[model samples]
Target: MEKIAAIIGGGVIGGGWAARFALMGWQVRVFDPDPEAERKIGEVMANAERALPMLYESPMPKRGEITFHDTIAEAVVGATYVQESVPERLEIKQKVYAELQKHVAENAVLASSTSGFKPSELQEGAARPQQILVAHPFNPVYLLPLAEVVPGQASLEVIEKASETLRDIGMYPLHIKAEIDAHVADRLLEAVWREALWLIKDGICTTEELDDAIRYGFGLRWAQMGLFETYRIAGGEAGMKHFMAQFGPALKWPWTKLMDVPEFNNDLVDLIAGQSDDQSGHMSIRELERLRDNNLVAMMRALKGQEAAAGKLIRDHDARLRGPLADEVPLVTVRRTVPVDWVDVNGHMNEGRYGQVFSDASEELMAHVGADRAYIDAGNSYFTAETNIKYLDETLVGEEFFVETRVALGEGKKLRLLHEMKRASDGAVLSSCDQFLLHVSLETRKSCPPLPDVLAAVEALADKHAG
Candidate 1:
């Protein structure tokens, strides 16, 4: 059966949710009363298509169907998942859910994108209330991994099913144990907002300055270690408990005005917006979002290399994405869309990045030859002794590309590989890399003969890929 998702209200969150599922090969139907619904969703999907694939190292599945519908009933008729991103008002959501409950299939998991309203609040006065849960996702949901799975008086089965569905589409479903007004993430966000508002209202910092403090400092640490872990690292030799002991006394200090909220007056809003524009007035909002996405993709991928935080999630998902390659043609070692972050000031992929790209491709070939992570863990693996690269053409961001690789030689302890990087659009050879490698035993840190099984697999591949 084809996996289908029905999205209620084609707003930013709804459109993003649709993009996430649709990009993962799920047929998505969206319903909204607005005439501009399709256009809005198309815009969101365009942004999603450009950025989401860049986050993955493996070839993505084919993009799926995205159809806009006129009515909720029509949209939900056969959908396996129904996500409601209606306006934040409880009455509006309740009215929509009442109608939604009437049409959605019994097996479909019903979800809400409400950030403030608890699942219990949304569950009241609704038919099959147990089916509805607060499935809140952050803005730009296509890139971010978190999807807060807030359960109400719902069955554990539905929540578990929802969790599976979210993970299938590359989202981290954080199950909130006890439901409250805003749930976990937003409450933390609210605390930060209060402090930021105070800073702005007191003229202590401009909006740009406030943002700079985050992006340049704690944000980097928070991206990987988070608050607790970052604090734990700060403890030096003693660790988290010692750090808490040293910092606990400061908790009583009046360091922040968390209890107070500044009025979101028009002047304050204007002041903040004016400062923001002055800071990044050179780029359009779309251009800014692209920049932001590129930075995030780069940061996340860097973390992935270290197997930390959100990077680990991407790695885990990428591992599941791996499958056996076709037995025809050159082995497709690296197939991916060029991420925006790879582009340098010259408007092409950086020279250093090309090396990383080829290395990744070579790693894929190694894994295919039975010299994968396990082989490395077992203290034996291939190490590139030398690489000769020729860049035939410049590659830009979001360009589809693949590497054709073949084993040129596989002897007792020596291996040689050939790689050709081609642009998908024109089949142009953008680059080529010829790598010389040696199997090494990690325990002794010395050249060693390859394992018998790995050598056999390598020789088989070499024969098949022979000229």
Candidate 2:
């Protein structure tokens, strides 16, 4: 059966949730009270159109259609998952939950994208609390894969099932042992945010300076390895125990007030927002989000090559969120054995030249999309944002091999591509490269929606592999 997910609210967070599930190939139905929901959701989707494909090297899954619903009940009809992102008011949330319980399918999991409220509060009067839990996602849900699942007295089996479902969609679901306000990740972030506020209020640093310290230092470490792992590494040859023992004495320093209360006064808010304005100068929020996602795509791509946790996330994402399949896009013929130069010192195919074969295949894809030299001359081109490869067999010099490119997902401004590298002689599988690329406007250095003809071609490619 085809998996489907429904989104309610259609605000920034709702739009992100819609894009996240939709890009992963789930049929999505969105319902929102906002009269201008379409325009706002369109903006959010536009950003995702460019960012989602760049998250991996391979093609993404064929995106399901996004259907707009006039009411919440209409949206949840046959959904496997229901993500609620309505306004934060408790009574409003309660009302929405009541309505959702009536319409959402019995077997479907219901998740709330509430960051501040506990699941217990949202599920207080829920008819199916066991299936209702928190699947809180960070703001830019399409890009960030972390999904903190906080179950509210829900059955363990239900929680696990929900987590597994989320994992299938390329998310890292951290199941909290017990229900708590804000849960794990948000609590940790709150601590840091509180401290940052104190530092700013005390005139210790500007907003930009605080951001610099985090991003340039610990942020880089945290990307591939979490805080605990980094600390364990810092402990050196002695390991975590010995390292902690040696550095335990420094804990007594009066450097931080971990328990200090923070006052969210208007003056403080104005000061911070003003400082932020000065730091960013004139870029709109959309522009900043785009820039941030591009950097994240690049960073995550590098991590994928190293086979790190983040890299594994990208792989899981590719396997689940496949792009439009290029089965009908007649396979290009390559009849040569692997050249000696193609095999690096490691006795496997080098990473760089995987592009050469893929690039040759991409020519067909570009032509299929109407992006020929004329398109390039018109200031449009495709840029590789990310790629992940799995080496299954070692190919030595003179080992016959051939590669085939297939469209795994195609939509909006991005495309997910999958390539199979196999030995030509015995037909042994060699490797696979999964990539995400953006259809970019060279002049703007930003993504532009594919033209109608190009979009039509993409739809044809996607349709040929719909099964």
Residues 185-301, model 2: lDDT tens digits: 889998899889999999999999999999999999998899889999999998899878988888898767678866889999999999999999689888898778767766776
**Backbone clashes, each candidate:** 0, 22
Q: Identify the candidate with maximal lDDT.
A: 1
Query: Least lDDT summed over 10 consecutive residues: which range in candidate 1?
Result: 320-329
Predicted candidate 2, C-alpha RMSD:
15.7
Candidate-wise lDDT, in order = 0.89, 0.78
Clashing pairs in 1: none
Q: Tens digit of lDDT per residue, candidate 1, span 349-441?
A: 999988998899888888887888888898888888999999999899899999998889988898999999999888999999999999999
Q: For each candidate in turn, give its C-alpha RMSD to the true structure in angstroms.
A: 2.1, 15.7
Q: Who wins the TM-score comparison?
A: 1
Which regions of candidate 1 fall more than 4 Å away from where they truly are? 440-449
